[model samples]
Target: MNIFDIPAQAWAGQILIGLINGSFYAILSLGLAVIFGLLNIVNFAHGAFYMMGAMATWMLGNYLGLGYWASMLLAPLLVGLVGIVLERLFISRIYHLDHTYSMLLTYGMTLMIESLFRNAYGTSGLPYSAPVALQGGTNLGVLFMPNYRLWVVGAAVAVCLATWLLIEKTRLGAYLRAATENASMARALGINVPRMLTLTYGCGVGLAALAGVFAVPVYGANPAMGSDLLIVVFAVVAIGGMGSILGSIVTGLVLGLMEGLTKVVYPEASTTVVFVAMIIVLLVKPTGLFGESR
Candidate 1:
């Protein structure tokens, strides 16, 4: 099959879809980057929290009669609060331990959370529709672009920028960065180290939850939704570099486009292309594309 024979519309459609997916990747990986970069926690349960965000949205809409906008606002806030609670109760206790312990604890938490959700939701997956206001598509010459998807991309971009600005520009961000580098020094200077750590973790979890909230309208609410996508998000983080914010954001968008191109050129290879790229990156620069050498 000649590449030239493929319709432009097909290419455009896939790329648009890829961009939407990349937006989700960017948000989710940003959260992972923050957690790992600042708190040094593995946070395998990030995915579980993500699932909770989506499920909580569905429950809010279904059980409480909350509309899309309300659910969207409430879900992440609720999930973030839960994250703060969990950090205070469990995560803070392990901060002094090796990273492996954190990973094991979070992974165990993932299993338990997924199990409870799966048992309750029963795997059929709850359906979520785009808000009525965004239920249409716009003609974009090459292909029709769904308004909801466009909104998703726009919203994700806003979230990413806000987070970047918060961490890189603000005074509070300086304190957070200082604490990340030296908790004892930060404490000596009158910064609340423990509180800062807890807030950082909560913020990371909140980002993941926000991604999940955006995702439900597009992907629907499934108990395994987070776990399934979690693998790819992890790859995005690794490819971007574990703790590099810009790396996570840039690599995610690039890989999403790469995935789209692969799907267009060779459908069979699309799924494995990310892992293949991940392997090459790991072999070439174990520190990651944007990671600084420690």
Candidate 2:
């Protein structure tokens, strides 16, 4: 084989890994986009929601005797309800304030939530088993792939597309945008602006939680898990465009592919490649790859 040539197995494996990571990036950043774009709140506690998803899934299994499939359905809903409560009690209060205020408040919440979980569960991570149906691997031509991972990628993609459609193409989405653009005008038009904001925030956090539930099947349940990837996911949002849903999905998948390719071409640069791409994008277009100027 030529020095420049790469083996199919190695390439395919890395691509799979990258796609898996990208699936997560797309989902997480999409949530951030929805929250910021519609609600104007910079939610720094998204990672905690992610962790909560995983923790909730784990708890459902270990405590409630719920299996993976059932937990997957229930955990995100549970986390989302918690998010709604948080929104009503805390986030709503800061809605009238600047984005910095929301960011700071959510950041404080992140710290507090993390600490509480740490105290209760300790730092050790909990394992979550994949459903029996997804326990094994499939034999692809190039490499063996896990059924669960493939499911994750497909599910993430479906969720992202559905959300994008809902936001960009639906009557309800139009109302969301209208409320976002002019709350007073929307309220005059008979839209429930405040309720809309509350629901949007809850949904955004729910998206983060859904992503977290996807993770437990792979990385297990850990309080700090979300914090670990929070920065990278933020970089993803910035690179894609701060509040652009489509941008988040596209940038996440592309950057994920780049990260994987970098791991193959040069292992050391894989970690830094995303930030480097972010810096480049920021320099070239501060509005992000897809952001519209205000």
Candidate 3:
């Protein structure tokens, strides 16, 4: 159990795996945070949207010979466009009502979407293999890591950083923040707040779709994938304190790594670690590790 005597390869392998899983949690929770921050909607259908992205990639690949790269780009755009339509057609209608109404509406939308997918694809899981270009592994001195997994982790980190910069350093981000905080004020100042809202929702949904595209090869395309993931993501967001996008990304990766470590010591506790951490976080800092006390 000494530090130098520990199994280095096994430890490195688990860490790599954890980092990859963390990447997914970070990107997914980031999408959730952005939507919640701007729209004030819980977006219960976020998971479904993510699932749809994976399914879209699978269908495109099978029917049109779309590669992973193409689907990675195309799926998000298509799903994002769908989100725009959903915002205009449904989300906009609930803006003036109580929060509960919107939550219920979104929940209903999730159920409908899930049911539709279940009817079409059945409950069984589908097979999805990693693209040939990234199907192998390489030794990194200490451990062998799958190329695709590395890509996923690198992509997620880059995305999270890019998004953080976009929101914190860009003019568009300024406008977005202004419009989100005070739509009427922004509208008076000549900003098209409604259009911005729709676009924001699209972006959020797009991020989810992006996560889905990346996840399909790893997790496969399935209807229940979203609901199951959604619960975990909710915990990630809650623990990270949805007020800050960067916070969400950081917390997700941290929890993901923690879960991985837990798996090494106590396999049975892996699944419970995140929730346990979440509970402890809530007890100590009700708003979360980086959440604001508004």
**Relative to the unseen true structure, what is the C-alpha lDDT of residue 76 in candidate 3, on a scale of 0 to 100?**
95
User: By lDDT, highest first, what's the ranking?
Assistant: 2, 1, 3
Please report, in order, the local distance difference test score of every candidate based on alpha carbons: 0.91, 0.92, 0.88
Which candidate wins on TM-score?
1
Q: Please list the residue runs of candidate 1 whose C-alpha ends up more than 4 Å from where it truly belongs after superposition.
A: none
Candidate 3 lDDT, tens digit per residue, 32-107? 9898877788888999999989999998899999999899999999999998999999999887777798789888
Worst window of 10 by summed lDDT in candidate 1: 253-262
RMSD in Å for candidate 2, one decimal?
Answer: 1.3
- TM-score attained by model 3: 0.95
* Candidate 1 local lDDT, residue 170: 99
lDDT of 1 by residue, 1-294 (tens): 789999999899889888988899899999999999998888899899899999999999999999889888889889999999989999999988999999999999899989998998889779999899999999999988989999998999889989989999999999999998998899999999999999999999988888988999988988898889899999999998999998999888888888888888899998988899999999999989998876
Instruction: Give the worst 10-residue stretch by lDDT in candidate 2.
Output: 1-10
Superposed Cα RMSD, model 3: 1.7
lDDT of candidate 3 vs native?
0.88
